[model samples]
Target: MSYRAPWWLPGGNAQTIWAAKCSRRHAGAAPRWRRDRWSTPDGDFIDVDHAVYESRADAPLLVLFHGLEGSSESQYAIAFADFASRNGLAFAVPHFRGCSGELNWAPRAYHSGDHQEIDWLLSRFASLNPARPLIAVGISLGGNALLRWAAEWGEAAARRARAVAAVCSPLDLAAGGHAIGRGFNRQVYTRMFLSTMVPKAMRKWQQFPGLFDRDAMLRARDLYEFDNLFTAPLHGFKNTEDYWARASAKPLLADIRVPALALNALNDPFVPASSLPRQTEVGHHVTLWQPAQGGHVGFPVSHGPLGLPGHVLAMPEAVGAWLLQHC
Candidate 1:
């Protein structure tokens, strides 16, 4: 396949490499976000990390989902929570399974299409506190998962949450994956994702010896290969192809009846501009924002006179305000 860099993936994916570099540059800079424990339906206890603003009673609840290889402690996660709290909204950042700083006991790991896990968490939240408005915000891979859930489950998931906002979602996962698989872009993501994922797979192997083909798992460096061998089979998908086919949000967008804000920059380094779905086709339920620049979450905020937050962090506010007005 001859790959043309999506306006997001600049210099034929050199920008993709730079995004990873910037992610590392700002890594570990986020403040300490709190962690909480919740029990799964299977009678397994799982630790879910979250960052909250103020008490849950007075404020509307906003749940956030982080990107690939991200946690509640990610800078955007903390910034969103901070913004929510400052504006009298309460929020929680749910760390994916095994990504919450504690190794999850369950044999399963988190994936972009893991709706059941999110369902379990939301159910718990509703049971504990009812009658409060709930909203969800997701970024990148997290955004993709939320979009898939909304598209697949529709009003069921929408009923549980008032509105959804997804930024930089790889809605067309297959396309996004293929886009990033080119040249140094492939190497950049493969290395970063594998660096974390391989260790986790290794840990799982330690707990359950002979569970995975150790050599094959090690050899799988990119997202597609690793996911096809491990995640797809475990999650009931025939393989990575099946998983990507089912999980990509493009097919489900028309089914989403609830209000949602989908924001992406033409210059985002992950998802290509052409991959962005047409908002008119999504009906009145979706709003698509295509900023000319952001560079895959690298919306640098200027502090000279106008103290505007980076576009990445300011997105929650924009969406939140829009939701309050529309929803």
Candidate 2:
């Protein structure tokens, strides 16, 4: 099933904003989540929320990795949880470090291309349920990291998961960074991210005293500057440019061996259409879905009176169905 934006939500920015602010009210029923905190190999703990229908013990497990600063409570996560519950599938959302309503003990926080973390977490999930099939989906930053894991693992990735999907991910980090740093996106989206991110970094600094230049981190006005100051240095990258170049999943799309879907909206404000890979650019096992109008992660299926956005389930449901088909 393809996406068609509601008539009231005309442009990409409107679709994106409305879905983020108002779509949750239209998300019907929420799944009952059981939270589990697992200790990472690095002595840090990551929280995972599980929604399982006990009756369907043999069902495939749908693992969702959320976007930057997003948690299990995120709109898309809840929507996907509802989709899994309705379909009788087991669902899981693993929180990236320091994103689960609590600060992590580790000196480092999560990044857009933390593929090693993805590899470890997913492998642990697979090991815990050897009998059931695993299907993974990542949104935005989480999506980029998941794709990196798949590409790095190649055919080896198939042993742990039947399929994978990335929704509205910035496959090309440089292009995405440059796009999000300009004009209205810089004013609104970038600021929204840094509002949470900068404070988090400051808290991390308190944990590990003098971890980075606190003054430079505070002066960061955009994602590029913040990443340069905090994300790159904390993650062992030389700088923001190095991090974006090495962490990007676009350069290695052809290396993914598992059944993978890279879905992007041509009008995604964060990810430019020009950076999206073509059919010939990826391996035969990979599929690219570049719809004309689903802005960022917002694919509004309906709209209410007076231009209020309604349900944003079409994209999630469609992506969920695709993952299940592969499983």
Candidate 3:
């Protein structure tokens, strides 16, 4: 599970940042996604996109959970969809609360620990496809959520998904938030997140006037600031620190009971390596894949000096290989 960086992209930052850039540039034609609406118990709606392959009649289901502010259209999600479709698997990406390009009616938006949505999706998928195996892959923010969910569910989770894989998750949210606030991360990646997130929150405010404090959200600088101002209050946490403590999955890893794989890069800029859960700390079924290199969700971009496809496709390719052997 040690992912190698492409010869061209050296170090963790280069491997991470440049691979993301390449994925942005060459994700190719957008996949045709079928949008479906589901009613949440909270009186709000969530959007889920389905990508079907014509090749198979009853393919196993692969559920994908995207990063913060990302949707089915994200480059990595598209890559996984392609991988699923071509290999006799069906794919679906669940857009967290308001991230499906539509404003959710509720003032509450998604945070790092929304297990209700995960339960909703899993229950429905299991009901409809009684016999089909279920697999989940969570990336970044979504990855953390999935890991925590698995740990909480323990043996109960094993029945839902045969296997789970988390890629580049901020398992330790406090470390992650601080890491993104410092040095180049603050200037580039953190800024990129806030730029997209602030506008979305603003739109939600406009949609529910007087419900959310738009002024405070707009004044926030990065993830930690935004969470302190908007995310914490909306989600019932006392503050950002409280939210990070309760929401981080690192402490729960030892309890996870389902077959699972958690992947992280030693050089991942967003997730400090020191925060990753050690193998001995996790449950008997969990496996940690700390690839020496492979930035964020840019799996397809490269796979070490061994190198596969030119673009960022190595991730799905590697996952496919793993699934074939293990799942």
TM-score of each model, paired residue for residue: 0.86, 0.97, 0.92
The residue-by-residue lDDT of candidate 3 on 195-250, one tens digit each, is: 88888888877887875667777788888889987788888999999999999888
TM-score of 3: 0.92
Q: For model 1, what is the error of residue 136's alpha carbon versus the real structure, in angstroms, after optimal superposition? A: 0.4
* Candidate 2: tens digits of C-alpha lDDT, residues 1-327: 477788888888988998888885325456778899999988999999997456466789999999999998888898898888778888899999999999999999989889899999988888898777999999999999999999999878988899999999999999999999999999999999999999999999999989999998899999999999889988999999999999999999899999999999999999999999999999898989998998989997775665454787778789999999987
The lDDT per prediction is 0.70, 0.90, 0.80
Clashes of each: 2, 0, 9
Cα displacement (Å) at residue 173, model 1: 0.8
Candidate 1 residue runs with Cα over 4 Å from true position: 1-32, 50-56, 305-312
TM-score of 2: 0.97
Prediction 1 TM-score vs. true: 0.86
Q: Please write out the lDDT profile of model 1 over residues 1-327, one tens digit for every residue.
A: 011223433452443343334332221234345667887776556565554335647467778888887877665676676666666776677777777766777666777777667677777776666866777888888888887777777789878878888878888888788776676667776687789998998898887777668899988868888887777876778988898888788777888877887887776657889889897668778888877766565444332344321123454556667665533
Better of 2 and 3 by TM-score: 2
Sorting all predicted structures by lDDT, with the top scorer first, yields: 2, 3, 1
lDDT measured at residue 267 in model 1 versus the true structure, 0 to 100: 67
